[model samples]
Target chain A: MKIIADKPKLLTETPMHYCPGCTHGIVHRLIAEVLEELGKADNAIGIAPVGCAVYAYRYFNCDMIEAAHGRAPAISSAVRRVVNPDNLIFCYQGDGDCASIGMAETVHACMRGENITVIFINNGIYGMTGGQMAPTTMPGVKATTCIYGRDPKKYGNPVHLSEMLATLTGPAYIERVACYDVPHVKKAKAALKKAFEIQMQKKGLSFIEVLASCPTNFHMTPIEAMDFVKTQAEPFYPLGVFKDITKEEANS
Target chain B: MAKGKVEFREAYCKGCSLCVNACPMKILQISKRTNAKGYEVAECVDMDKCIGCASCATMCPDSVITVYRD
Candidate 1:
């Protein structure tokens, strides 16, 4: 028998601590597979954010650093300058860490065209903090802080981080993808591969915003949370490549 | 004979059922059996019906399933 599919070697034997059914696991697997396929598994450095994936350092087999809350991009920037040019640097961050507190760092990284990859998990709520409403929380999404659902009038509108960053001239690639099903999962993996490839080519920053699900915090079954991402989240944060310098150059 | 076989790393499975839903052949189901974590693990009810598609493995967030084919 031939093995058609198995776990990526880049992922450690250590079981991930992400909550059951959380989409973070899928993202982690995708990143591992991408790194392995790119032949950069040994040369990859990951920056773990202060969120549900704070323990991410345990799962990835390569070098990993735990960055302070909303400081993953800042740390990634420093790592990029010191690491070998062939080495791949990536930051894994959550909406709370990337869109809220790390907003300035993330935007500046893009503006500076830092040659690194940022995997942003936008789960709409702060999963590690008991489902507090996040900066990317959609209107009418209930959270601990917004028990009655977020009110745009009082809380302001959800921030579209990818779109905002795409407007900058620094970033080389920016895309929004989701993994609610098999097809989307495949697309997400493809996007990750492209992002890493861009980084390896010494292109500018590549930011991928993944619309993930927080089933445990959402008070829904895993399947139900997947449906929520497909039905509710997708509509608000449409999926597609927001920016690609290669495409622009070709068009020009 | 079945065209494909699937294996489960039960220890790593979180029993989210995403793989069951992703199976195009509809042969996967959440079993009454639970892992050490007490989560109901997914099992292939009819291996004969598997088409060697890795959809289940792709959709599985925990990477619990491995697919093999002759």
Candidate 2:
């Protein structure tokens, strides 16, 4: 009980408005844990996107900027260049904000080797926009936009963000993780912390995409949602650190 | 210490019985009452003997268990 209160320096005393069992809360906790671990809460600046985490400005205790739909990378770039170089910059976005609307900005930001960490939440459904299908929406998965399930013919196949981004010549690190359960959630925490560490090393841009759950829109109870994500979604998305500047540094 | 109480939020549980059999105390039984989602769940009668091992929470496919330790 005591440990919970003193947990993270990156979050505020205000409670989250996200629905119960929504991975937004877990994902927020992971970022806070990273801030506390790195002792950068004082100098850290976070950008909140226009999705479910748009309310993140209230939850995260660090200096936060609410960006337009999918424009977090652009905002982060401005902050990283104009603001203190020693300051840690971070951006939080969902699939719609990152993979779809912000793809152009995100890709360009990474190619420029922007020194920042991007926390991407891939729930496959547009949570804030009423569960519309997203670029990462799995094939055959039903969404509000795709009443008959996503089809590669019309909608095309799901975009694999990490794999695609890893092909880029810039980003210092790129990883994808899950927030569905304890083990996977812990792995996500470690991955987020590593992204910050990558940034600290001036290793250029780092990205971490977390597979989150939209229980209300997914039409699943909490546990059922967990099961669906673990068994069905994990096989499709997978999880791993695709690139590591430190590992590359050790070799090259 | 007597028995501890196990509270299950049926809405949060996914009907996975990993907790029902995980209790080594053998004091747990499945509840006949179905939730709004129509999942047959577990109910603990002899909570007095519960050692608070949290085996149910660990084995619980759903993280809906709140164990009160005595």
Candidate 3:
């Protein structure tokens, strides 16, 4: 008589608009589950960014704000500033939003050590815009713009956002987890839950980057996209906790 | 009697087949019938064989699958 896999109460009943096989919905569910588990669903404030997940405001049951592209970090920081200090505030952003257009805001927020959680979805393409090359796109990945495959010498290399942000002293937690497999999906949920926990502790800047699959953009079957995420993406964007200041604080 | 069960919100399934591939029991498959959303949805062929591993639910990006144990 136990409920095993019901939808999280924090997730709205609204059906998602993400493409089939897109991993954004899984991430959304993970975050919603975390919010419900922490008993912060009602107190949670989510900032939705412009990209594939722009409609996220309609999906999460908590109060949400639609922030300008790449400005999600800035708006989230401001929300964290004016809102009840103990309330949970987070940003849901894509690679193009967080690493490309919002790169400065993202980096600055981490530098300032803003006590906010950033759920970054790195699918390595401009998914909503028909699969263009993104800042996080792999060096040799083919996209609409990079039909010939990404060129390191011409277009530069993929930006390791988690690794870059981890170098800053401001972030209390940073982790990169993928959603292509069961074990990794479970790990992703754990990472997201830990990020929220860090925010609750008033630990500054918790960033979790999820390497998601884009089957439509990748022009591959859902299963093949999962394989691509494992074989190609993981080699470039290795998974694991990049930083956890709570551990450092405990050890010290 | 079925030992386990799984239900798919057909309207939400994008017919991605992730669940069909993830099901270790090999009891799930894409249905020929499309849902209200016009995408083929996943369907379990044999509820009796389900182990309740929930792998289909875990790999479903749409969160359309829900599993239950009896």
Please name the candidate that would achieve the greatest DockQ relative to the true structure: 1
Ranking by lDDT: 1, 3, 2
All candidates: interface RMSD: 1.0, 7.7, 1.4
lDDT of 1 at B56: 89
User: Local distance difference test, per candidate?
Assistant: 0.93, 0.80, 0.90
Which pairs of residues collide in model 3? none
The 10 consecutive residues of candidate 3 chain A with the worst lDDT sum are: A1-10
What's the TM-score, to 2 decimals, of chain B in model 1? 0.94
Q: For residues A1-252, write the lDDT of model 3, one tens digit per residue.
A: 344776788887888988888899889988988899899999999999999999999998899999998999899889987989989999999999999999999999999999999999998999989999999999889998989999999999889999999899999999999998888889999999999998998978899999988988999988899899999999999999999998898899
Instruction: Quote the lDDT for A178 in model 1.
Output: 99
Model 2: colliding residue pairs: B2-B48, B3-B47, B3-B48, B3-B49
lDDT, residue B2, candidate 3: 65
> Could you tell me every candidate's TM-score relative to the true structure?
0.98, 0.80, 0.97
Give the per-residue lDDT of model 2 (tens digit) for A1-252: 011222255666564556546777667867876788788888889999998889889987888999999999999999997997889999999999999999998999989989999999998999887889999999999998999999999999889989988989899999989866656777888998989998998989999998887888889865677778888888998888898878887998
Mind giving the per-residue lDDT tens digits that candidate 1 earns over A1-252? 799889988888888777778899999999999999989999999999999999999999999999999999999999988878999999999999999999999999999999999999999999998989999999999999999999999999999999999899999999999999989999999999999999999988999999999999999999999999999999999999999999999999
Residue A190 in model 3: shift from native, Å?
Answer: 0.5
RMSD of each: 0.8, 5.6, 1.1
Give lDDT tens digits, candidate 3, residues B6-44.
Answer: 988887888988888888889999989998889988899
